[model samples]
Target chain A: MKNIVIGRYIPGNSFLYSLDPRTKILALLILMIGVFVIDHIMHMVYAIAIIFLVLLLGKISIKRIYLGLRPLLFLLIFTFTFQIIFNRHGELLFEETLYYSPVSIALAAAIGIFWFFTKRFIKFRLLYFLMTLLAIGTVLSLTLFPGTFATGRFAVYEEGLFMALFIMLRLIIIVTLSTMLTMTTKPTDLNLGLEQILAPLKILRINAEEIAMIISISLRYIPTLLDEANKIMLAQASRGVDFEEGKMKEKVVQIVSLLVPMFIISFKRSDDLANAMEARSFAPGRPRTRLHVLTWKRLDSCVLALSFLLLVTAILSRVLL
Target chain B: MAIKFERVSFQYTSMDNKGYLALADINLSINKTGEFITLIGETGSGKSTLAQHMNALLQPTEGRVHIFGITVDDKTKKQRKIKLNPIRKQVGLVFQFPEYQLFEETVEKDIMFGPKNFGVSTEEAAKRAEKMIEVVGLDASYLKRSPFNLSGGEKKRVSIAGILAMEPEILILDEPTSGLDPIGRNALLDVFYNIHTELDKTVIIITHDMNTVYEYAKRVMVMREGVLVYDGDPVALFSKSNIDRWNLDVPDILGLTRDLEAKFDYKFTEPPRSRKALFKALEGMLK
Candidate 1:
């Protein structure tokens, strides 16, 4: 349950924390665009380096950054695999064919056995399992599928492998960097910053304040809702709900038992919140006084200038090199 | 012993990675079935934390907890497959505001959910559900109604019925009458009383209501700031010289008894445990 780590803010005072919310929001946008603008491995390296530099300056724990990345690990693997499979540029890396001989069968069985046990025992089991899947896929293509690895026609392109790395690294850096933004920035400031940044959208009649309020309220209630949901789960567990020891169908039923109550609770909470908001006279679009007026300091400007420079460098590198 | 905690301490780790001790070196034993024990404390006094340990819901950070001889401690960690289902089945915990646990379409299904989860046959589960609904002073017809449709008090009763359907030997309720009116509170307390006396279950309750404590509790455990301050017969608990230091109000009847003693200088033996007891004793004295 703790794995739902998004929207969790850890209070800190660092360079990133001190930056104006608008500056932080803009920097995140530019950096995300820079990630996809990568054309060379060097560009990827530079992007990763900047991310690490920001993380270091923020004094955020690497373990927390890694924890933030945990939920995306599976999606990262999927994207990486799909990139390798679909991209067919550059020369072939390897080609092999194994006929149905006793030695080949024994080798396949041995690999399967190794994979099965390593998958169960290894610490980084998911990564090891992915490698095992790749190995088994290669072997199966060689023995079962004739036009692929079986006929020595199956090939993994070097460009495809490099591209996949670039994409995966790009994804991880973007997510980790954005998580840094959220982890350091208070939700109130985040909402205010977002409101400030989207002030221009008011020209088009969009209610930016209400949108910001929605985001802030949602962010604020995340931990509260999570805590409530956890309590409910425990209460149900005490009532003999063995969530871990159920069959798939029974597990679905158990999940319904949890999710339905959660839905009810969230709805009731929102209704109560709306009532409270109305009682407090929180009318939308009314001019409000700021407790902390966001003043753009010289450091905020310097950070913004540096990010823009990085963004330009990223684009120039994509174009020239 | 029904439940035993030996030097049990529980530490909760905050997001900042600092461990705060919630329960500290609590050594206690509940030995008998049909023994009504009430744990009374202010909020954050570790009353609920201690109650949770009784059902193995929260494990001790230091020392051990044994629920009906099922060891839950460092040794259970080594074994890795010590089934807690049996222990949990025997020790039913009805959480505060437990009505929130109800999610099934019908009250009967919600009530039977516990027994069914424990692998009881549907028929037997239904039977238990009907019986528990009656036990909680609800009609059997309530079995088919949506639990969501019930009033706050009725929802609480249904939720209690869900736990009672498990037919646990040791029943623990955390502030079971918290938000109820007087009548609702009495009705719920009656359900627990029946569970204790009639069904012969060892009932442990955590409450802040001193009146409820005096009325129902045979034995009372007092906790203050994670420490077990007092544990004994409720009558003995109230008579202690330092009872005022515990920061608990004396139950109303007992307060009246003391007031009567102060006014008349009567050395009354066998102080009343309930309003009825006090009234009967007062009539006897007048006659």
Candidate 2:
């Protein structure tokens, strides 16, 4: 539930905070391009440097970045494991013949059991999860058996490890960059910026304002829907859901017990919201007056120029370096 | 005691205000049976937070909460994951919009959800559902209807029945009768009161309705600014001079009692329960 902290804008009066959201969005886009354009892992130092500089300017804490990364930890680990196991590009760093003996299997089970039991007792849950992951990986790859048994070769290649870390780093950068954008920019301003940016789509007769409104409204409801969903979760939990502990089949049922209600609630809410909007004489795609209009200042242009320079540096590095 | 809060303080750190306390230093206890406790408060006064703590839906941020004698504290919860299924079973919490919790295709299956979740056999759960639908004053035929399609009141009753089907020893409801019309609210209150008396279950309701507090509650707890300002008999607590500071709406009966005391200069031993009772008390005072 805490992971869905998207659209949650942290208010600050820093330089990044004051810049036009359009500039920030453009900056985010260019920086993202830069991140992807940089093929070498070391070339990512430019993206990392700018991000850190943005972080310092924005007053966005490392803790917030850590929180942003937390929900993707499973994804990161899975990719790392997949790359380590499957990718066979570079020379093998290590090759081990592993056998799944009864004792080793029992040891794996014990590790799982130990993690399941001891996890609640541990305060640093992410570290504990990683520790458990490491333990399981070690048991899977390194365990040896004496008897003639079913065995497999576990090989760790240099390129695979490097690719895995690179991908993970790439993902972290993208997530952190987006997190920074959302964290710094208010949702309404972000929507206005989106509309402004999408204005060129008018050539195809696509209404940018409508699209922006849709995105804006959707962004607005994420927290509300999440709050409603959290309430429903607690309600279900009270009915003996044990959301964190149920079996696979029961968990599926439990999920339906959650999702259906959520679906119903969202529909009901949207209906009411639509009526409310209509009552307020809100017509989508209609030119609307704003209480606080977004303005692009000289500072915004400077920031955009900086982003352009970063992108050029990235592209130049790709060609020349 | 079914539930006890020993200096329980909860803070909602999810919000921007890091120092905002939802529940501050709450030390209270609910009996295992035969108590109708109404928790009254301003909006954001932590009544809902307090209610959630009763069933271990929320553990205290500070201090210990004993749910059916199982202590939930920083130390204990950190030591091991406490099995809360039994605790949840024994304490049914019907939330503000309990109807939203309903997800089953039919009312019967929806009501059976809680009991089945607690591992009651399907037959037994069905039986409990039947009994509880009746208990919540819903007809048996309504059980066949989709809970999603029912009127607001009916849906609420079905959701309540879902909890009641669990046969919790302690029932904690957060503003159970808030949105209903007078008759509907009265009927729902009557259903809860009957459950309180007949089944002899401890009933704790967090209600904004001071009338509900004055009418049904044996023990009334008033919270203001996350602090328990009052906890005592409904009549006695409402009569206190400092009750006004909480900015609470004076219950109609309490208002009448205060009026009678002011106008007639007669201090009644009990707060009149109804208009007729008020007249009777006035008649007695005149005599």
Candidate 3:
């Protein structure tokens, strides 16, 4: 729960903290779109450079941003593997014999058995098992299949490798930059910014203020709910819910044990909170004056314009280059 | 010793990445069995942090902790074979509002959950659960009911039964009766008393209730701002010249005894710890 970085605002006085919340959100959106539009490798590097600049200017600890990415490690690996395996472009890197004889098959089988046992007993079973499977695939390609050790038969494409790296870098940068925005910006300011940005949507007869309020309320509750969930988990852990020590099957039970109580607690809290809010005369959809109306400054405008200019440059590079 | 803390200190990094010291240079030890200990402190006095160390839930940031002679230090963390379940099994912690831990479909299954996790066979675990239900004063009929459907006090009892089913040698409760009504509080305390006296288990309670400290604790350990300020018998703790300096409350009966002695010529031989003992002294005075 402590590791959950989304919606968590760290108090700071960096340049990024001074920017209007709407500008930050808009800039991030543009920057994310810019990352996808860039086709060349050098352009990707330029995009990464821009992200690093934002990260540096934010003044948040890089270690904290890295910790926030920890939960996505498995997803990142999975997606990278999927892109590498399915992609078949650019030059072939190598080829080798994967299966040559019955004896070699038996050796591979022994290795597979070893891998299976290790996966079953290890701490990070999913990650270890996936990597082991990939290793076995590579070894099988090397020994079981009849081919030269270094030629183009069974191979890895350069484009596949580059695309995987590109995807992963894009994901990490986008997540980190967005997280940095929330880390530096307070929730009330973020809500006001969101309200200001979406106020134009009112012309379409859409109630944008309500949407921003909902988003802010939910964001405000995320850490509180996460805290409650952590308490429940610890309480259950003391009862011998070995979350870290269990087999895959036991993990399912452990998750249910955690989730059910959290569900009950969250629902109970929401009901109580609703009653408390109603008692205090808080009615939804009412015209409410903000305590801190967001005032846009020169820095916010400069940052927003620079982000837009960067987005245009990225699009031009993709098209004209 | 069941547990020992040697120059233990804990530093916590909250979500905001600010570090705060929760416990500082704490040294303490507990007997293996038949010791009823109460930990009294103001909030943030590290009572919970110290209890967590007893079962290796949280290792000390500095120095070492030994739970039943098994060292839980930084060096042992690298050795995966040194499992914490053994310590956790022996030192059962019933957290405050332990009822929140209940998640099994039935009360019986919830009680059986802890023993099952410790690798007890289903049949044996179920049997222990039945025995624990009786031990906690819950009826056999409650075994089939959903734990969530039970009343607040019943849920607390069932959750406590879950820990008792593990048959820990030392039972540690953190504010066991905080939100319960008077009858419920006494009922739960009676269950703990039975476990301590009849079963000969070591019971450690973290509480702010001075009355509970006076009536039940054989020894009281007091903490003030992450330091152990007092450790001795309850009588000695209450009678200290500067007991109020630590912001501790004396038990009502003990306080009343002192006030009565101040106003009258008759002298009470010694301050009694409980209401019944005070009343008995008064009866003797009338005779």
Best by lDDT: 2
Model 3 chain A TM-score equals 0.78
What is the CAPRI rating of model 3's predicted complex?
medium
In order, the Cα lDDT scores of the candidates are: 0.84, 0.85, 0.83
For B1-287, candidate 2 gives per-residue lDDT tens digits of 77888998987766654566888999998899989999988888888888888888788889999988899875654555678767899989998896569999899999889999998999999999888888777789998998888888788888888898888899989888877778888888988899899888889888888888888889999888889988889878876777767877788877868876998787886668766788888788888
TM-score of chain A of each: 0.84, 0.84, 0.78
- Model 1 interface CAPRI class: medium
| Model 3 Cα lDDT, one tens digit per residue, A3-87 | 6666578787888888888889898888888887888777888787877777777777878787778778888888888877778
RMSD (Cα, Å) for all candidates, in order, is 3.3, 4.5, 4.9
**Candidate 1 C-alpha lDDT tens digits along A146-256:** 333223334568888888898888888988978988888888998999999998998899989889999989878977888888778788888777766778988898788
DockQ of 2: 0.57
Tens digit of lDDT per residue, candidate 2, span A1-321? 554555578888889889898998998899899888998877776577778887887788989888878888889989988999999998889887767777777787899999999998899987998889778768866546445357788899999988898888899899998998888888899888988999999999999989988888887787798888889989999999988787899999889988999999999899999999999999877778888888989999998998899899999999999
For model 2, report the TM-score of its A chain.
0.84
Per model, state how many residue pairs clash: 0, 0, 10
Error of 2 at B53 (Å): 1.6
Candidate 2: list runs displaced more than 4 Å.
A3-8, A34-180, A313-321, B15-19, B75-81, B257-271, B279-287
By the DockQ metric, which is better: model 1 or model 2? 1
Model 3 stretches with alpha carbons more than 4 Å out? A1-11, A34-151, A154-180, A202-206, A312-321, B119-131
Worst 10 residues of 1 chain A by lDDT: A144-153
